[model samples]
Target: MLKEAVKKQLHEGTVIPAHPLALTSEKKLDEAGQRALTRYYIDAGVGGIAVGVHTTQFEIRNPEFNLYEKVLKLAIEEMEKGNTPDSFIKIAGICGPVEQALAEAEFSKSIGYDLGLLSMGGLNHLTEDELIDRTEQVAAVIPVFGFYLQPAVGGRIFTFDFWKRFADIPNVQAIKIAPFDRYHSFDVVRAVCHSKRNDEIALYTGNDDNIVNDLLTTYHIRSGDEKIEKKIVGGLLGHWSVWTKKVVEMFANIKDVQGEAQIPSNLLTLGQEITDANAAFFDSSNSFKGSIAGINEVLRRQGLLQGNWCLLEKEKLSPGQAEEIDRVYRSYPHLHDDEFVKANLTKWFDERQ
Candidate 1:
């Protein structure tokens, strides 16, 4: 059961940035700088934040492990400048071996965060029994209000059936639902729902492109005149998206169609803008790692970020490529509410006209 206090206090909106902590010098920003970084994201309209410290990704860990405490302190300080703990869902991440997650989670819990995000994978993959053991151990101490485990990708979707077994673990509140591919993402949601597994578990679709469509619509698959109505799509997750605008709007739009078949018109419009830019961005980068780097650069130059170069890599977008992306960015209006914002809407509406 969702904690009464947690559920009651969950009305506020939260945002989780794809925590960027590239190990390179250029990408690494100090605690004060990171607090400033977090402030930018918070100012973008999130009531809370999810930060990671293990990888050069999202964690707030200072160079030393003890910084987790500092991260929490900084987050608290940053948030108090705008809101309170009850209004914020400050989630912290801890990833590594099972023992490491346990120790890290203990530290995170002590920091008094609203939630925790944990990750671990090694040696092809752990057996089902081992995964269950790990889940049991973690949830035992930490009030794992959520669990966003990545699917067995870079391997082959955990051979022992992770979805069913992991959901079986009590207090495993949710999963990020990152399919190795589109088909797998769709499959994971379908299987989870069909199996009635972890009925309360939130399914957060991390697949960027199809999120608006996939997490907002049910799938109708027919075979031999038999129609299967699947809620595999249209996830009722806690609204996690780093590729779009702020929370107040993101959650508002998603909640408008909770159980319905359609997303709000505005969301659809904004989603297309993302799709278009992603086309340009991805086309230039291609690799997932490269795509993140490219998008961060674009957001940085647009004055959306501090130009921390969140992802450090040997390759930088060529000056010509930078110009090309800026050209694409220019296509977007100053305010999302501008009349031109609905360019996609006009086209779609015209098709009906």
Candidate 2:
């Protein structure tokens, strides 16, 4: 059964921060550290958590460790411990072959997860019709969140027609638009808006580079004589894993003035500032070599992590990436919720202990 709290949060607009893996010096999943990360998001007041997503590293699904099930369990356990009212939504990343995706979706439902974030990773090179069939198979098991992961990170760009059909699926709850290309991003919006189930499928911005602007955008969709307006209600982003208290506050600020005729001038300026921060944190300016590492660095600075360590040594931040991260830290002090992190870091760690 869908939890009332999760359903309410989705419709009311809220941030759904992506979960990042915390690794030990031995490059193993640090149970304490992972729990700390989950509690941090809860303390920061994120309405939901997306575990096992790209930010958490897809390698976790490999047979050597098979960290997928463990990661999901850890997140839910920590979420339950931290969430006073149990309002936090849990979205497990469900991908791989059709059977694997179906299995994960069933497992997620068994664990009380509200939704499954479906990626087209294993279905690559398949015809669109075949892809749609795979999606429907998983949707039968649980409500699925369609993903538009950027091609920069091994994501396929589904045709607009494909998206239109995908949205029409009854159990597809939302779409995370992260194409990063303005044109392709709109294709998702257009597809959903034109779908008969438009009202049923919500839109979330996974475009880390244009988060603020995406939230501020307004799309008017015309199907027949009826005109329906669409807006990116919130986000499910890896960028949100760090400085999350501030991210939640930023979402609140945007929600306050959504659809207003007189938008605060500062809100416009924030878009550029956030993009600059994302460029550095995402390492987009440097071929994204520091993608996951960049996020871990921020947490390290906040004392939420031991260091910028990953399971794979090759995933370490690129040359000069540290300097770029340091530059953004100094330049965009407003963006980091350092104060909040400092105050809660010790407590978060203490909880795990």
Candidate 3:
């Protein structure tokens, strides 16, 4: 069961970065680097950390790597050691079919994860009912954070019906709406607004492309004679993994202006700037083939990662991807947390000793 404090935190909204993998030059898990990255996120003031997710490389689940359990355990261990608040959420990325996802959910629950950020990436073979059935099975084990991952990154497009039915699942505490399409994004909002569990489900934007605006705008959905209102409270994004200190600050500013009639123009400009940076970090130019690598590259640059190596040998920065990352580094220095990571690097590493 989800803790009352943690559930309250999810509803209140907070930044939760899709945690990335840290690797050594030899293409092995860099345990020190991984711990340090966890430390980095906590110290950066993020509300939560999601491990074993897309940005952490789904390849970790392969038998050859067998890092799914290891990564999840390591992150939660670090989170506990960090003296995180009662509301600091620990999310485990749950994937695969029913049996596999169930096992993972059970293991995550055993290890103290508050929610499962369930991914439906490779389940395209299942019909919509089958998909919902799978979700119900997983939720029976642990509280779920439903993910509407964008298709560009191995995720299928879930329809409004799917989302509406998903919201009905009793244990679904939140949904990360990351279709990356405005219409699809709206579909989730409208579906939830119309659901019986609308108030119970907190909407978080996994739409890295529209983070700022997603948080600022309130959706007015006409449900029967009443106009129901909803908002994307926070983000669960890979784009946030890099520059997280700034992301936390930006989220705070966005929250401060939530009900204001006139948003400051600078927030709008910041949104575009963030999107521009995400394009470079997420490799939008290359169909996001290098999205994971791009995230690692930024961390490597900031000294949070030892090197930008993914478990899959073929996974590396795309052509001109590094140059684009450099461009964003130059273009938006304010978005980075280089100095924060630098100041605490040694201390974080020493704590692990």
Model 3, stretches more than 4 Å misplaced?
Answer: 351-353
lDDT by residue for model 2 (1-353), tens: 45667766776678888899888888788887888999889888888999988899888888876799999998888877774465667899988888888898999888878899998865567899988999999988898889998877778878989999999987888889998889999999988888999888778999998998899888887877888899888899999998899999999999999887788889989988988888887889766778999899888888888888877778888788889889988998988998887777778888534
Q: Write the per-residue lDDT of candidate 1 for residues 1-353, one digit (tens) a residue.
A: 33455543343213444443322244444554445445554555554566663222433343533345555566656666655445455666756558877887787777666556655544246766776687678877664533333332222354325666666667665555544266666555554554444355555554444456554565654434556554422222222322334334654566567567545687777666655555455333444334444544644543334552543344345445566566665786432322322222233223121
TM-score of each: 0.71, 0.96, 0.98
Candidate maximizing lDDT: 3
- 1 or 2, greater by TM-score: 2
Off by over 4 Å in 1: 1-5, 8-15, 21-28, 53-69, 85-87, 121-125, 145-156, 194-197, 219-247, 261-269, 279-285, 302-306, 310-324, 334-353
Candidate 2: misplaced stretches above 4 Å? 84-86, 351-353
Model 3 TM-score, 2 decimals = 0.98
Please report how far candidate 1 places residue 186 from its true position, in Å: 2.6
Provide the global lDDT of candidate 3 against the true structure. Answer: 0.92
- Per-candidate local distance difference test: 0.50, 0.86, 0.92
Candidate 2: worst-modelled 10 consecutive residues by lDDT: 79-88
Better of 1 and 3 by TM-score: 3
